[model samples]
Target chain A: MDFQPTEERRMLADMIGKFIQNDYPMKARLTAGTSALGYCPEAYSKMAQLGLIGALFDEEVGGFGGSGFDIATVFTELGKGLVVEPLNDTAMTSGYILAHTDQLELVEQIILGQKRVALGLIENGADYDWSAPETLAHQTGSGWQLSGMKTCMKFAHGADALIVSAQTQSAPGISLFLIEAAAAGLSEHSFQTVDGGNACEITLHNTPAQLLGAEGAAYPLIDAAAARATLAVCAEALGVMERIKDMTIDYMRTRKQFGSVLGKFQALQHRVAQMLLEIEQAQSAVINAANDLQSPTDERNRAISAAKYSIGRIGCAVAEEAIQLHGGIGMTWEYDLGHFAKRLVMIDHEWGDQDFHLIRFSES
Target chain B: MDLNFTEADQAFRQEVIEFLNAELPADISRRVHADLHVSKEDTEFWHAVLHKRGWLTFNWPKSFGGVGWSPVQQFIFEEECAAAGAPRILPFGLKMLAPVLMAFGSKEQQEHWLPRMCDGTDWWCQGYSEPGSGSDLASLKTTAVKQGDHYVINGQKTWTTLGQHANMIFCLVRTNSECKPQAGISFILVDLATPGIEMRPIRTLDGGQEVNEVFFTDVRVPASNLVGEENKGWTYAKYLLAHERNGIANVGISGQKLARLKRLSLSQKRRGKPLADDPLFAARLARLEIELRNLETTNLRVLDEFSKGAGPGPESSMLKIIGSELEQNFDDLTRRALGRQAQAHMPEVFEPGYNGPQVAPQDMANQSAAYFNKRKVSIYGGSNEIQKNIITKMILGL
Candidate 1:
């Protein structure tokens, strides 16, 4: 019956917020995202030390704090920092799938910061049908052989292995296979994402791969895993959005125009208020989706999609209003405003964009 | 934040649904659910039913003869009522003025007015808007000059909704001509039966007499009728308007409309298929439903906070803007879904028991009326534009 965050969660929130405030500034984040390595190795190590990686899973999965609130709290703080790392894909998307499999060794390595994983699921022009994998896998004497082009392998250049999904000859649906990053038949073309994060185009030719879970049953797991990833993505976007609102409002208070602060204009003030209204609602949707993760499949699915859609929709609003409120300077690359705005747009495209989720939500 | 209702709250919700299902009249329910032009009798009948059940004054304090439900209970009551097609109890007397009287009226005023309002003796309409001072309400020039033991009033109030059926009117009058536009206003209550007062019905865009223009020519009222101090009317008027906007988030009503829209899109055909099967139309409907869901949650969050004893703020204006726009958007979609048939209906098409040629389906005959009448949703109750200004002042401190 309580609408307020618990004392424990509030403490966690304040600690994480301070960690980001004290350690990760916008400039450092920008440098890390646009770096040659595509991330700050030192900062990634710090996050592992802070138990940020371990916070995404439960005790049975070799970690603690796996409640929906934990995920929401962590991602929200990270969003405020605008930290560009591969934790979303590696530790969340691939991490969930790995936890469900009998890969105790790999899961422990991930929490201990000894190994990094990347999800190689999406292919060129694949629009969110997780089971519609075009990559093909065939049975071999030692292990299965995978051959396909996987687009947008998040943090692929940095990860030690890839959780690649491909269609198996014997399976009716797509199956997940774990392939080493340096497997003989693998090649990668790495680049930074639009929001200044790392991803790669991975091409595999008869790549040696090990099945993570039971063959032919990966689609449901993939669907559920994708739901979890989308939820994390939304929570992260909520963090980014609150920061944008804060910065925009602070700018309004100090930035003067025509003998008064820009916030003095009723028109601009109203627009900001409207932005707050939307983001508040978006936040509620995220919380609801987070809570509904363990509910029945149908209810959970609808809520996950609703959360994704609301965050995406509200992300654009926060972006537009923040930029407009900041006026011309908001769009500049050197300023953090433009970065937050761009990340909001990118968040919409991940998992399922607003349009995609809307159709899914309506049809379901 | 927990969205789970306690078991007791769940029980309360079920009780509300049961009450509404058993008591609401079927014919009036049909009109409300379809957004048809509801007669004054329909509203009165529903009002009396709620009153007899000791629920009509749920928003009032218990000591004042109200049900005195918590904000969550109030929300549940409203949600059930709107969902079950119950006519909205007019707020001019119960919701708006009653709160003002409770807060500022003298003991005699409370004893005299509160019981009558409970028993449905007085039907009230607001006298805030004029021809030139709709949004800029402080510029209102409805003069009420002080005289011997009374106040002499002379001015015109425009867009007085339901004034034709009202027995009393609450007005914001210009009491001091030589002071600030805002500071000089006074609030007065005048009996509609007084001489030199004229109420002319104004047929709105929907071709219904939903609003009126009330003119007062030297109408005198006892000084005791003033709610608070003279020249403090603007403050009271603002308070009442805030109350008006408070419940403007009509999420339950919009939920019903969205359901009806879904039903229509499923049964109605376009391009040789069900309208719901059309990709673009389906997308629009889905977006509307998502917005409605989000609005509902946000509303609950606000009501939850209010139940914790938080005062009403101008954030209500934000809710008003969202809720009104959704209703308007739904109306537009309903009409469009009816296709060419929606445009052919007039006022007579919705008259109860009119068995004319089927224009739009019998259930959806009010699409055109709903669309045209709902255009005023954003314009009245101090307009969405005024709401923005209030939000800016209250939140942004601009």
Candidate 2:
């Protein structure tokens, strides 16, 4: 299959890449390290205003480009910027659901970056078993009551709403619900992730909710959505990996040991080469998955699992090797390698860890 | 965006499959499929068949008597051959030397060598690696000094694979000693029948004489035998090495081996259970399969670029690195599948008709030898270490 993006997509990439280079520098990235919202809110709006949120959706849903490569292109640029905002939570998951739920009003707000949304899918000890969600949703007339705890509800700290997946005690399967951040009986304790973003342990006690899709049949949607999230994170991780590699290579070229650059040594060169092969392998998997997005469910799952497995393993490798190759300076906070490395490792752990994806790959 | 082949491509694939099934001798196919020893006559016979069909030098351009297939067509032909268990087209003559000749050889040299190379009259061997020059190949010490009308060549070349079957050799000789290491070299074609030359078999770790050592003591060669200018062998040598590297990423061969490994593992038992059923083994098998797919895609990408005449810059080295490593992995797994049977390295069992050793089945007995031979895949082609250096220089600019 052709790997080259179309002219339109390339222009989109160029714009986004230039934006990251011109606006989102190390200072901008580091400023969000301790911010109250854990990111630059103005920058978030600027990203949405630049059509990133819309670029990931369709014209029917207030945007233009929504292909797999389109999403990959956007995330790759975001990854290079080390953009602290959670696009996986806000756009890929919540925005996806809102677009599919026939909620054009909410989709318009999201595309305008006037509001934010997060998906509450993770539980503390669920171990990535998304199909068997523990959050309960009970029907009350036309509305529903959601009562459960979602751990690490990314971007929910200051979001307009949360797209929560819950099991129905009466219907016997999981369903998707749109719950407002101000919904009654809902509480959260927000905390910072190691990678410089905010997430919360959200507890909902019969929180009023609006159904987003078919009741008791949201498992497929949840699976597909989570798979998309995994794909997005992988693309982002690849972007971060390239940046780290460039920084490490620069250090190797300039840094001297025994009156020669460290890069002249065969050992470090081999390590870098190994890192590149892993990155290529991981990239091939993501591209494969991206193309398979419109294929059958089995095909999609197989590709997604393979991509996640490769990215998780390789992302961790580039992360650890980028630091070790940089020597003592690699570990210090002032160096951006540590930050990007942190993002890489955290990305690996977020969707599915290496071991999890390896076994899942076998099963898939 | 489109992966499907055109109607013509599909027809070509079918034609290739049908021809292979009809013309490939079963005995040679059986030997290749099982990694069993095949006689030189068998290889020559298959070579002659392809030569007659004008498909022997598949890598060359149509102007040089090649089939002129597209990169995709070349890939399809190779994959089908590997799948059909056809013996590999020996690289020394067709894949390696022919390209160099087509590029830089004089008109007389091309007319004399290319035809013979295609018709199986000239079995060729490469004389690049010396006793002290492998990865540091530029420092090769093989010397050739010009006399009145001839050049006297003297030095030793090691690891000349299948040299015993070769009647011709392409060598890198140091024609100028005062210049830099790479600048002083020259490429020369030598006839095996020349005086002052001797060949001796070097038994490899697998107890096979597939390689040899050739020593020269003032071997006289006509000065006109030089392919290009004096002190320019390094350029042609590098060109040939790039071609060799492209073949090292043997995706089709490895894919066939993977299929065989899975089949054998399923039939073979480990601790009273089928090895394929073991989770640990299965996971590794699946992982290997996944990496193979990745490499296949990567190869396609490289070929796509090459089809556009980019000719696989630094990426060939990456393929060489991974392709060799992947082969070793497959060999290691094959040995593991053999379990204790791999310990029996009876050389007689490797003899074509020897059925004496019954402790291990013939196919199982083949694993250790194949594994040992595959160990050199990474070491021989400039070594994976050198490949990594190439990658760093090309991709990382370091």
Question: What local lDDT score does residue A228 receive in model 1, on the 0 to 100 scale?
Answer: 83
Candidate 2 lDDT, B312-353, residue by residue in tens: 477888899888789778876775555433433344454668
Give the Å shift of residue B150 in candidate 1: 0.9
Off by over 4 Å in 1: A1-364, B346-352
**Each model: TM-score of chain B?**
0.97, 0.95
Overall lDDT per candidate, in order of appearance:
0.79, 0.78
Each model's DockQ score: 0.01, 0.01
Which pairs of residues collide in candidate 1?
none
Worst 10 residues of 2 chain A by lDDT: A123-132
Tens-digit lDDT track of model 2 for A150-204: 7666667888888888888778678889989999999886655546677666889
Q: Write the per-residue lDDT of candidate 1 for residues B189-305, one digit (tens) a residue.
A: 899999989999775534456678899999999999988888888788778767653457998788888988888887876435677986867988999999999998888887776
